[model samples]
Target chain A: MSRQASRLDAKKVNSEFLTLTYGALVTQMLRDFENAEDVNKQLERIGYNMGMRLIEDFLARTSAPRCLEMRETADRIQQAFRIYLNIQPTISNWSPASDEFSLVFDSNPLTEFVELPPDLTNLRYSAILSGCIRGALEMVQLEVQCWFVQDQLKGDNVTELRVKFVRRLEEVIPAGED
Target chain B: MSTYYFVIVGQNDNPIYEKEFSTVNKELRKEDHRHLTQFIAHAALDLVDEHKWKTANMQLKSIDRFNQWFVSAFITASQIRFIIVHDNKNDEGIKNFFNEMYDTYIKNSMNAFYRINTPIKSPMFEKKSEIFGRKYLLS
Candidate 1:
């Protein structure tokens, strides 16, 4: 192979390597702090910052960028939740009976092969997910409250995460006239 | 002898599996971690939440000097958290040990026998532990 081509290939490989390396590093940090709630808070803060950069990357990588509308962006986010994370998020009706929109987890990869210790039965372990989704959405400037409504470990067999959007992120939005 | 505590936290910061191990030379009961274990869990939670906004994946070695212990965290996709804690003296070995262990853990989690937020009592854990000790500590 030509030297230039070799260099280019190396660059491509190097970039790919960096991506996995970064992913593993983040997963490892979350793992280390998994035992400490305070550290987990720090981890989430780290995640929020990451979501900001990641959103930029997500936009740069795709060929067709802009969503047709606000609802289209929301749908794309839902699709990304599945394609990227392997977890399909269900959108539920939020009416008088329902408090907020929820992203239900039919199969949670994070919780697989996990059993809660007896003491934590009352306290939900999935708070990290809520915090994460909230942090990610917040990066896009969406104000949301995400929490675990049901945990499979608690015998519900279905994990439900609810996201209540408080308001659109107007501050980050572009300005024209209002 | 040193002691190590490891856990896998989901996107929600919930523990999927937790295991406590003291130096193989020392015999310690799992029940001993009742209090310290919770303390460790809380610390990890704090670290995860604190880094919720950072774009780069991090290795926060020795976040606390008082304990002479270091924490290594891995956060993926703004989802999934994996944490391992150990002493500073053997930090190098611990890193490689965890990298290998993670491969096993991921494979183990994929098995039908596995479920989230549960104790990691699979015989494979012991088998892997023994192998890890032999490969790293024995030499």
Candidate 2:
């Protein structure tokens, strides 16, 4: 699915609009939350909510089949990000157990001109993406932990996120016994 | 033409949101039918659970029938279940209604203040849902 060309044409939007709106949102969140951690949590929560909805759009658009393995899930995410965001991240550092993997993004549009202030250096500017991936995967019953291990804003050449599969959820049948 | 009851069930089997509307052509009822509609919708949940594992698809169409009422369901991958009960059976229209409702639910979920399993109190959500019901299910 990752190799196939996207059927939907990319909708063009003014980059300025995106940058300005996102920047304002972040600024307002920082102001309202006061604490950087709280801002991060808020951002993640927003992303999680968005992800819960986005997966539907993705499935409806792509009609991609369910992923049976973690590796396939990684590919699906890569394809989804590429098609939607137009940024392809390198999937690497797969654990022997195949329960964890890292996505290294050479360029992240979300952080194009985002420069974290020295006081808020701890802020993960793109943490929302991690939260989105986590929330979307969780909906598919793949319980996983997603976090940014390396961020370009933090002076790293590549922004990387590590996803660790916690466990697979068995569908709890409410009335299994006849 | 018949009355329609919509219910959204959370992953924990809690009622997250619900609404009742009759066909646009029919006169709206003044009687307090909320409790009865809720009861029928709640009873259908048990049937939804029993049938959920039987099929991989999300749309559990016409799962149960009580008198003239028929239940149709659409379960999101996140386990948020959108169920609709009505007298007339129009499978395609019900599917479209659920799809639109899913979109609205997603938009509601995107709100930073909103949390899972909580009743949706957003006026915007309520308004959109009403519009969808009128446009698709009612008409």
> Best candidate per TM-score, number?
2
Write model 1 residue lDDT over A1-178, tens digit each, in one string: 2123224334443333433444344345546655435544665566556665556545444433554343454565576565445467777656453435666778765555454444445544445456556666666666766667788867786887776767667774467756
Reference contacts reproduced by model 1: 0.00
All candidates' TM-scores? 0.41, 0.52
Report the poorest 10 consecutive residues by lDDT, candidate 1 chain A. Answer: A1-10
Write model 2 residue lDDT over A23-78, tens digit each, in one string.
67887788888888998998888888878878878887778898989999999999
lDDT of each: 0.57, 0.83
lDDT tens string, model 1, B2-102? 66666767756667666655664444444454466546655766766576555464444333322555566655443556666655456566666666766
Runs with alpha carbons beyond 4 Å of true place in candidate 1: A1-43, A62-73, A96-99, A122-124, A172-178, B1-139
CAPRI-wise, candidate 2 is: incorrect
* Model 1 chain B poorest ten-residue lDDT run: B57-66
Per-candidate chain B TM: 0.65, 0.89
